[model samples]
Structure formats: structure tokens, C-alpha cells
Target: MQPISPIGVVRGGRRQVHEDGWGSVVSRIDLDPAVFDVSATSGLDAYSHIEVVFVFHLATRTCTGTQHPRGNTDWPLSGILAQRAPNRPNHLGVSVCGLAAVDGLTLTVHGLDAIDGSPVLDVKPYLPEFAPRGEVRGPAYAGELMRDYF
Candidate 1:
């Protein structure tokens, strides 16, 4: 597989790995000037939201293959792939955040879960056409696990 590199870096948000209270975090994603031209974000403002794909650089890798969500035994045991924990195989994260503005190579967003200094892998406009087509369902525990995850 080809190696991946960051297109940008997150500027502000929770610096720690605490899972809750990410709803109001505002962040700036500054694209690497050497890697991309300012025009890279030219028409991105047309979309109300964007999908930010980033790396969980701070999560310590763990060997446990399965665990209760958030370490809560009340939730059923789930495989690492079945959960959204950052310590999974790839340590990658994706979040859909409100697009506040696009200025040159910088993008201002709301509710981005990535922390300051996190490497941003990619950014894509949120297109409703790509939404799930059929009924979406998951275990009840998953809902509680994301109750405050934004």
C-alpha cells in the first residue's frame, strides 16, 4: 500500500483524549502550504458540512481484541472493529463537522473531534446523496457510548 501523509493539521480543540464534550469545539484546519495551493479550498464553502479524516496520534495502542464499549461491562463485549475506539488497528478517525468558513488554505469548522496538532488526512464535502439508503440500526449500547461524543 502507498504511504499516506497529512494534508493539514488541526489547530484547536480538546488536547487530551477525553471522549465527551466535543460538541462545541471549534477548530481550524490549516493546509500545508507546501503541499497544496490556497485554491485547494476555493469552492468548499458551498457546502454546509465537511468530513474530516484524521489520525489519532495520541491514542496508545492496546492488545485487547474485544472489550465492552467505553470499558463499561454493561455494554456487550464487542470486537475492536465493531467499536469506534481510537486504539483500533489504524488509529484513524472521521467526523462530519459544520463548515464555518474557508479562508485560503485554512478551514474553520465546528465540532471537530480531533485534537490540536492532529494530522488531517483528507477533507470532503458532505453530500447528502451519499447518506445510507436503508434502515440504519445498531446495538443500544452503541447509542449510549456516543451519547456525548458529538
Candidate 2:
């Protein structure tokens, strides 16, 4: 099997900040402008949002496998595949962030929840057809807090 190599590294100041080993951090993505110049998206300002793929660099190997999750403690533990926990076997993170603006090959995005210096895997324009539409379904109480869900 081939090992996973990061396409790019995240540049942020996120780090372990809790005694419990948990933390809150923000991240920034630095993309190579030259890479985009050859593509149709050379003028990225045309899009309003972008999808970013990054690595959970802070996730220790021990954090992988299974977890009961915060509110679902009474619902029995679930394997990583069954949940959205960051401590997965692969430790990869994907998010769709609002496009604050596009400056040359540099893009300023909003709402990327990751630590600084995380490894970036890829980035793609957010297409409406690629995104979900209409009603969303999920565990009853689990879906609460629409704003904080992400």
C-alpha cells in the first residue's frame, strides 16, 4: 500500500491548548498560484466559495478507531466510519468555506475549523450540484445547533 502524502501544508497557529488534550484553533490555506494559472479557474474571484481538504495533524494515533461522541454517550460507541469525529484513522478534514476574496493565487476564506500548520490535501471550487440541497436528515438531538454544527 502507498502512504498518504499531503499535497500542501496548512499554515495556522492551532495547537494543543487544553488540559484534556482538546483545543480550538483556526487555520489558513496557502495555495500555489502557479498551479491555478494553468487551469480554467485562473480567475478564482468568479466563485463565492471553495472546498478545502486538509489533514488533522494534531490527531494522535491513539485518537483513531472508535469514540462514543459527546451527546451520544448513552447510545453506545461507534466506529470512526459511523461518525464525524476528527480523530479518524485517516485524520483528514474537508470543509466548504465562504470565499472572502481572491487575491491572485491567494484566497482568503472564512470558517475553516482547523489548527495552524495542518497539512492541506486539495482545494476545489464549491459547485451547487456537488453540494447537498433541500431537507437534511440526522440523529434528532444531534442535529441541534445548526450554526455550531460545523
Candidate 3:
């Protein structure tokens, strides 16, 4: 398989990684002009939200075992895949955030958790049809961990 390439770069958000308090952060994703034209985002403004697929470019670890979420001992240990920790293999992160505006090839978004200068792999409109079916359940700790994550 060919290696993945970033279609855009994040800007004007948190400069460093933080576990929480990302609710109001506004960011801009500038699509590479060499690869994308303004028409690429022509119809994207219709969506109220979007799902951003980005690389955790600063993640230094590739943990593959069970660990407490956010190093909080109060939470139960879970496999790397069970949590959204950045230390896992592949360093991929996905967030469904509010779409603020789409200007040409530049996108302004709210609540994106990725840091400034992060590489964005893809952006997709958030569709309710793609949501989980039936009941959805998770450990109580998951809610607590995401209380301020937006």
C-alpha cells in the first residue's frame, strides 16, 4: 500500500497537546494548493459538522497493551484500541467537530482537538445516517474522561 499523504494542515489552534478544554477552540485547515483547488470545498458548507481524520504527528509512543485511560488509576485498564489515546499504533485521530465555514479550500472548524500544524488526512461531512444503530454503551469512565474534551 502507498503511504498516506496529508491533504491539509491545521492552523490557529492549541500549539501543544492537552487532554481537555477543547470546546471553543477554532481552527483553520488550509488544503494544499498544489493538490486541491477552491472548487473542492464548494458544496461543503451545507453540512453542520464534519469528521476530520488527522495524524498525531507528535505522538511519540506506540503502545499496544492495556492501560488506564489518561493515566488515571481510577479508570479501568483497557486495551489501546478501546481508548482514544494518542500513544497507540498508527497515530491516527478522528474527531467530529462543528463546521464553522468553508472558504475556498480553507475550512474553519470548532472543537477540533488536534494541535496546530497537524496533518489532516481527510475531511468528511458528518451524516446522521452513519451514526451507530440502537443503544450505545461505554464505561462510565469514558464519560468522565471526555467531560471537557468537546
Using Cα atoms with residue i matched to residue i, what is each candidate's TM-score against the true structure?
0.95, 0.72, 0.97
Candidate 1 lDDT score at position 30: 94
Q: Which ten residues in a row have the lowest lDDT in candidate 1?
A: 61-70
Arranged by TM-score with the best first, the candidates are: 3, 1, 2
Report the lDDT tens digits of candidate 3 across residue range 43-145: 8999999999998999998889999988899999999999999998999999999999998889999999999999999999999999999999998888888
Best by lDDT: 3
Give me candidate 2's TM-score against the actual structure.
Answer: 0.72
Model 3 TM-score is 0.97
lDDT of each: 0.90, 0.62, 0.92
| Model 1 C-alpha lDDT per residue in residues 44-141, reported as the tens digit of each score | 99999999999999888764599777888898999988888888878999999999999999999999999999999999999999999999999988
Candidate 3 global lDDT: 0.92
Candidate 1 residue-wise lDDT at 36: 93
In model 3, where do residues sit more than 4 Å from their true spots?
none
